[model samples]
Target: MTWRASVLTIFPEMFPGPLGMSLAGKALAEDKWALEIIDIRDFALDKHRSVDDTPAGGGAGMVMRADIAAAAIDATKARTPAGTPLLYLSPRGTPLTQGRVREIAQGPGAILLCGRFEGIDERVLEARDIEDISIGDYVLSGGELGAMVLIDAAIRLLPGVAGNEGSLAEESFAEGLLEYPHYTRPREWEELAIPDVLLSGDHKKIAEWRRAEAEKLTRKRRPDLWAKYRKS
Candidate 1:
């Protein structure tokens, strides 16, 4: 089945933005995957089409209404494939990982809810049993970008979406490493030369060198990942 991504957001125009220009775009055009854009405002009950309001007990910003969010989610869920996971993009959610992206990509697809302002009401998330996922620790103006980031990541993993399937296996996080540094032509550029092992064309030695470099970089740059890699 074609991998699918449904995004529900207040800003519908933001979607298929960057996702419409790169490898993801190519896959989309080829029907390797599909994108569904749902405007949250379309579910608003108010005459002004407002979807958010002042947080209960007072807060700094408006919170998205639970009713509207539920309405949008339910409508989308009805049309999407059964068992497709529903995800809400939030800073407090579990940090997204390559493993999770792979799992989602292998599934039927996902329904992403892009929260705005302070965020969607907790009740809707609880009632729908939606999973919250964070792209990173930092917060953005809204979840639209997060939704796009997630969709793009998953789409590339769909079969036939990537031009170089072999390269995907060596990409960063493919094996819980940061990935070894890469070098290109102009083998000797300025002062740097392509690693001798790479130029030697010895697959076995090249692989060994790459593993070592990946380990070194991971240990120095992401001790968290390195620690997990070691334990595993």
Candidate 2:
């Protein structure tokens, strides 16, 4: 299924490069999905096209003007389908997960709002059915980075987006564990030899070795995800 996504941000140009440089770039040019970048500044009303204003309670940094942001959202919505779902990127939100990416991929509804400075008004969120998703628990300078992360995750799930079907199935979070180790043409590095099992020419044995390595990697690196594996 083809998914159309729009990003509302003050720095629209910052994206498409960082995100569009590698696999995401190939996916975009190939039209596996559609992407639109809208500059929030374009929707501003002043001569300077200022989109931020002083905070209401006399804070340090300027807060993004609610009305300006709301107007940008409206403009983006105009380009989307009738029921497109909007997602606002913020630190004070639920951390994004793989499940969320798959959910968005299955539906043609996902828009990302990249906020700057202090942030957008909370009223706009309360008034809409928008989803607040954070890339991580840490705070970012702006939502542009977070939006890019979301975009990449969503793109990887699209059918034919990845050249290898097995690649997707073995990616971290595709199962309950991290990806297994990979080997290339070198076969040996710094006197370290490749696993003998991999060169045995037995596909079944190779698959089993990968699964075992993935389980070990998960238990060592992410105990929390491994715990879920145990429960299941």
Best prediction by lDDT: 1
Task: After superposing candidate 1 on the true structure, give the runs of residues whose Cα lies further than 4 Å from its correct spot.
Answer: none
Estimate, for each residue in 60-162, the C-alpha lDDT of model 1 and write its tens digit.
9999999999999999999998989999999999999999999999999999999989888999999999999999999999999999899988988888889
Native-to-model Cα distance after best TM-score fit, residue 121 in candidate 2, in Å: 0.8
Lowest lDDT sum, 10 consecutive residues, model 1, at 155-164
Cα lDDT of all candidates, in order? 0.93, 0.86
The residue ranges of model 2 lying beyond 4 angstroms of the native Cα positions read none
Model 2's alpha-carbon lDDT is 0.86
Candidate 2 per-residue lDDT over residues 99-186, each given as its tens digit: 8888888788588998889888877787766789988889889998888888888887888887786768778888889999988778
Model 1: per-residue Cα lDDT at residue 133: 99
Error of 2 at 108 (Å): 1.1
lDDT of 2 at 228: 97
